[model samples]
Structures are given as C-alpha cells and as structure tokens.
Target chain A: MKRSLPLAIVFIGGVVFFISYFVPHYISEEILQRQIMVEWIKVISLFAFVIGLYSLIHLHVNKIKRKVDNWQYSILTLSGIGVMFIVGILLPEKFNGGIQQGSIYDWIFMNLQVPLQATMFSLLAFYITSAAFRAFKARSVEATCLLLAAVVVMLGRVPLGETIRSITQGFLDFPKWTQWILDVPNTATKRAIMLGVALGMMATSLKIILGIERSWLGGSE
Target chain B: MKKFFLNIVNLDRRWIFLMVAIVVSVPLFIPSNPPIVPARPVQELYDFIDALPEGSTIMVCFDYSPDSLAELNPMGRAICRHAFSKDINVIGMAFAWPSGSGLGQEVVSSAAKEYDKVQGKDWVYFGYKVGFAQMIIGMGKDIVKTVQADYRGESLKNMELFQEVKNYDDVSIVIVLAAGGTVQTYIYFVNTMYNRPVSAGVTAVMAADYYPYLQTGQLIGLLNGMKGAADYEKLINIKGLGTRGIPSQNWAHIMIIILIVVGNIAYLLEKKQTK
Candidate 1:
C-alpha cells in the first residue's frame, strides 16, 4: 500500500504536469497547482531549516554544559541568532522590515559575510588561472591548437589585441573578439550543456511520471 | 638545491592567495585605464526601455542582497534612472532576502525624488516577501493577493500605479535584478509559465548560464556583471560606480593573465632543460 499509494500519486501528478505544458488551456490550472506546490515547498523548507537549527542549538547547549574547548563560539552564535530574530520580529514595516534590525545584519552582511564570500569566490580566479596555465601546457599538436585558441580568446577579450591590430583597425576590436568568443565558441559549449540539461530534466520528469524515482520523499521505499 | 628551488614551484596556497590579494587590491588604488565597454546587451536593454510607450508598465523584482551591491546595485540605479526619465510606470518589489526590501525602496524613492515622480502614482514598491518561488507564482495568479501592501505596509490595491496591475497579465514587462537563483526562478515562474516577457541584471559568474534562456526568448534582456552595469551607465551617459569599477576588474584580470604567462614560460623552460 505504501508503494502503491506513492505510485498512484506520481501517476496522476506526472500526467497532469506533462499535459499541462503541451496544452495551453490547462496552463492556468497547472499554474494554480504549482502555487500550492510552492507553498508546501516553503513550509517544508522552513521545517528543514528548523531541523538543522535543532542540531546547531543542541551542539552549542551540550558544549556549554560540558565546558568544551572554545565553547564561546556557541554562545556567540546563539546570542546573535536570538538578537537577529528579535530585531527582525520587532522591526516595523515602514522602515522596510530588517532595516530596524539595522546595522547588525548590515554590518555582519557587509563587513563579514560579503568579504568572506568574495574571498572564497576569488579562490576561483586563482584556481582557474592555475588550471588554465597547467592544462594549456600543450605538449602535443591538439593541445597546441587548444593553447592557441585559449590565447586568441584571452587576447581577443582585451584591448591589447586591438593595440596590436591598430594599423588594420579591423582585427583588433576587443568587443568584436569578445562577441565572437561569446557568440560562437561559448554558444557551442552552452548548447552542449543545454542539451545535456534538457535530456536530464526530461528523463527525471519521466521517472517521476512513471513512478520510477521518488527521491524527493527522502529515501522513500 | 633542487628541493629549495622546487619549493618555489610547489609553494603553499597561502603564498598564491597573498599574491592575488595584493594584485587585485593594487589595481583599486592605481587604476589602469580599461577602454570603456559599450556592449550590445546594455544597448539592447536601453533600447528596450527607450522603445517602450509612454506610461508603459515596468515591473521590477529586486532579488538581491547588499552583498552583491558592488555588481548589481549600480545597474539597479541605472534602470531606475532610465525608467523614471522615460516616464515608464515602474512597479518595484523584492522577493529575495528580507534585507533587500530596503534596497529596493531606496532605488524607487531616490529615482522618484530625482525625476519628480509621485509615489503610489508613478511607482509602487510591493515590499520584500520571503516567498521566493511562491511569490512569483502568486504574483502570476494575482499580483494583489501576493502583494497587498507597499514596502511601508500601505495597501497597494488602492494605489493608482497598481490599480491596472492586477496580475502578470497587466504588467507590460518584468525586470528582475538578482544575484543568485532568482533570475532563473523568475523566468521559470513568470516568463515561461505565463508567456510574460522578462529581463534581468545578474552577477557576472551567474550571467553566463542564462544564455539559453535568452536564446529561447524567455529573457528579453540581460545586464551581466559590473561590466554590463558600466555599459548601461555609458549608454545613459551617467558614468558612475560601474565606470570606476571596470579598470580595477580589468587590471585584476591582467595580473592573473601575467601570472599564467609566467607559469607557462617557467614550465616550458623546465621541460626544455629536462629534455
């Protein structure tokens, strides 16, 4: 009954969802159905966050009780969370919700979180540069072509290429080169990703429709 | 001697981090002149606004936080400035973080004051809601149902600007300014589902992924990164933060390229010696 019930639910939902796309008449009905789904999603997601916070709170509470090393971090986290919640709830709407929470969220967001996130992401710049340098080492014919392509793209995207081509006034436009890279090669790569993404989405949708995959229910048997 | 020499090649990541930090920061102080970028995307976006008829409705969902202020906020300013200048009926709202409600209102209020636009008549900001995907869906069904009040908890139903904007059906165009998944979510929730036209301004890294949607005509316009913001400002002849940001970004990229070239030359030289 457990499996059959889920399978039946899937069968009805899958067919309707699929049919809703092809038939415009059912689009409104489909949209309305999706609205309910979104509400449920928000509710469930908030619950999951609470579940996660339970662990966080438990860890800190236990640490404080046990006098674990560096237990002060827990106090800081809990207190911050408490204050944030209070301020968020206390803030009047005229000030735009959390602005009443004021600079605490702003300061934490700008000075701490923003820089930290940017720092983490800036790691990508270094990593990508390293990867490009290493991978474009080009010890072979194909690799050499790749290296040349990378070089062209790198130069093409900047004004230096234009400076080199200043006499011709044709081959050097960085915008033109950037456009070519983006329009031609980038589109090709993107198309490949798109095709793969589309196929995967369709396959997953089919699985849901046919009752073959039910992972959304968290290890549903 | 080999161990000592090779140690430089196999340097700790902290060393590279320090170098990158200095490289990126150095450019901010002594900006290398990057020729202005007047890209087509920004032109198309400007043209889109320019072409809109008088009193045309422009619905903007501010879906970013202050974290992306450096990248997306400048473009937001340009959008507000341009829209207000053209006498477009601007409807501003937020759906990302709760913090963004203030940011969204700041755009409209500042623009209104600058252009002498009457609030609740020329533009109405529908506040920030935590609904994310749900808000998009709700707005699609009934704009008022999802957004019954302004950023100040005032009723939007009674507002003249919102009087005609009942649902996705009424709004002429949807503009989403986002940092994360909000752009795609908006396209999915509003544009794709309802046949409503949409465009967005997004962070540089996240910008590349939306090309397919652009191709499909699901997204009519895009402003990506600080570069795009600069382009928009250039188009409008404002020349603000976006313009100032470019030289630093360009120089940072140049430094990384120089590093790449050095590393390659070193590797090639080492390979030859070994041979």
Candidate 2:
C-alpha cells in the first residue's frame, strides 16, 4: 500500500506536468504547474530544509559522540549554525535582530563567514599552481593539445593576454584567439554534452514516473 | 644544467605555493593600469542594460555564495549601479542559497544608496527562498504570489516596485551572478520555458560551460570571472574591486604560464637525458 500510494502520486504528478508543456492551456500551464504545483513545491522545500538541518545536526552530533578523527570541527560547525540561527531568527526585532542588513546576523555573515569562505576559495590558486607545476606534463599527443590549450587560455583571459596586442603592435591578439577557442570548440563540446545530459534527464524522469526507477522511494520494495 | 632542471622538477610543492602567493600579492601593491578592452559578451550586457528605457525593471539574481563574491559582487554592484543610474527598477533575489541573500542585499542596497534609490519603491529584494526551480517557475506565473514578501518580511503587495512589475513579462532581463549550476537552472526554467531573456556573470571555471547557451541566443550576454567583472566596471567607468583586482590576476596568470613552460622544459630535458 505504501509503495503503491507513492507511485500513484508520482505518476499522476509527473504525467500532468509532462503533458502540460504541450497543452499550454491557461489552467494547466498557469494555474496547475505555475501556481498550484509551485506552492506545493515551496512548502515541500521548506520541509526538506528542516529535514536537511536535522540531518546535519544529527550527523555532527553522532560524529562528536563517536570521537571520530577530526570530529572537533563538528563542534565548530554546530556552534556556527547555533549562533547564526539564534542571532538570525530567534532574537527579537527590537534588538536589530533578523537577517536584515545592519543586524548582528549580517555583521557575522559579512565579517566572519565571507572572509572564511573567500579564504577557502582563494587556496585553490596555491593548490592549482602546485598541481600544475607537478602534474601538467605533455606525455602524449592528446596531453600536448590540452597543455597548449590550457596555456593559451590562461594567457588569453588575463590582462597580459590583452597586452600582447600592444606589444606586437596589433599583430598578435591572444585574447581574440582565446575567444575563438571558447566560442567554437568550447561551445560545440558543451552543447553536445548538454544535449546528452538533457536527454538522459528526460529518460531518467520518465523511468521514475513510470515506476521503473523506484530507487527514489528507498528500499528494495 | 641537467641537474638544475632535475632539481626544479623535484622541487617541493611549498616552493610553488610560495611563488604563487608572492606573484598574487606583489601585484596588489605595485598597481598599474592594465587596459581593459571590454569583451564582446560583456559589452553586449552593458549595451542591453544601457538600452533599457527609464522605469524599466530588471531582475538581478544573486545565486552565488560569498566564496564567489570576489568575482561576482563587482558584476552585481556594477549592474545595480547601471540600473539605478538610469532610473531602472531593480528586483533582486537569491533563491539559490541563504547566504546569497546577504550578498544580494549588500550589492543592490549599496548601489541603491549611491543613487539615493528608495527601497520597496525604487528597488526590492525578494531575498532567499528554498525552492529554486519551483520558485523561478512560480515567479513566471505571478511574482508577488511566488515571493510573498521581501527580505524584511514587508509584503511585496505594499512595495511600489511591484505595482507595475508582476511577472517575467514585466522584467526587462534576468541577470544571474552565480558560481554554480543555478545559472543553468535559470536558463532551463526561466529562459527556455518562459522565453525571458537571461544573462549571467559566472566564475571563470563555469564560464566555458555557458558558451553554448550564448550561441543558442538563450543568454543575451555573459560575464566570465573577475575579468568579466573588470570589463563591466570599465564600461560603467567605475574603478571598483574588479579593476583593482585585475593586476593581481595578470601577474598570477603570468606566473602560472611561466611555471607551466618551465615545468615542460624541465620534463623535455629529463626525457632527452634519459634517452
């Protein structure tokens, strides 16, 4: 009964949405998909967020209890979440509370969170440089092409790339070449991949709708 | 000379890290004006916003986290400044991440303040919502019903900006500044479904992925990483972070190229000697 009920719901919802694209009637497209389904989604998404938050806290708590390697960081994570929640939501409006600008929530977010996240992302520069120096070798024909492309692209996207035009008295334009590579080969490859992905997604969605892909429902049943 | 090349090949990675750090940092202090010839994609975005009539509206979706603020914030700020300077209504939103809402508020409001643009009237931020695709699809049908309220819990119905602007039809363009796949989501749902013109300011890593969409005319324009931000800043004639940060980017790129070339040379030398 549990499996059948959920399957029935999925089939009805999926088929209606699938057919709505073709129908385009005001009631189906506007009222059903846009308004009605959208509200349901918003509500379901909120619930999903709550579940996600609970799952996060639960996982971290379990890690702490287990004394796992690097588990101390979980405490920091939980503390951050707790502090942000209290300052962002639980506090009263009289105290300049809430996630609005000028609030404590905004202050922490801008000062602490922003810099921390930026620093983590910035480390990519150091890591990529080290990795490239160690591993970016042209051992084969394909590797050489990739290496050459990478060098051209790296030079082309920066100010140094544009300066090539001035240096060669307008004879050499690395940026222009880079743009061609991106526009032609890059676009063609990306389009092919995207089309494949879209088709795969449609096939997967249809399978799930038709009850052939029941993994989302969980369990073997 | 062979030993020297071999030593370079075997040098500790810490040396590379130090070299990168030095190159990236040194350029910040010794500033030079690197001429920014605005790329075609960037110029298209600038021209599109420039062509909008006064009182027209555009939706700026801050679909990135603070991790991307360095590359994306400038684009957002530049777009807002452009829109506000021309008396265009700005409807900002961050449906991708909760953290993005803070960025959206900061970007739009900071620019709005410069032009003395009133909030709820001249500009309104819908803030973060949980449902990304559904929220976008809903907004296409009716924005007020989809968003319900602004970031501060103020009803969208009360906002003067909402008076004439109701849905995707009212929005002049949707510019998404994102670091992730949210831009693709906007492309699939908003552009493909509703036929609303979409553009993006994405991280350089993800920029190449969207070129196909640009060719298909799905995206009106694109901003690729910090360079794109710098290009937009040049067009807007503002020496913002994008401009300030470009010199460092230049040096870093030069350093990476030098490293790659040197590494390859060392590898080839080693190969010759072994043979």
- The top-ranked prediction according to lDDT is 2
**Interface RMSD values, listed in order for every candidate:** 3.7, 1.1
Question: CAPRI band of model 1?
Answer: acceptable
DockQ scores for all the models shown? Answer: 0.31, 0.83
Can you tell me which runs of candidate 2 are displaced by over 4 Å? Answer: none
lDDT score of residue B208 within candidate 2: 95
Candidate 2 accuracy as TM-score: 0.97
User: What is the two-chain DockQ of model 1?
Assistant: 0.31
Candidate 1 lDDT, B123-182, residue by residue in tens? 888767655777787777677656667766678778887677788888878888888877
Error of 2 at A2 (Å): 2.9
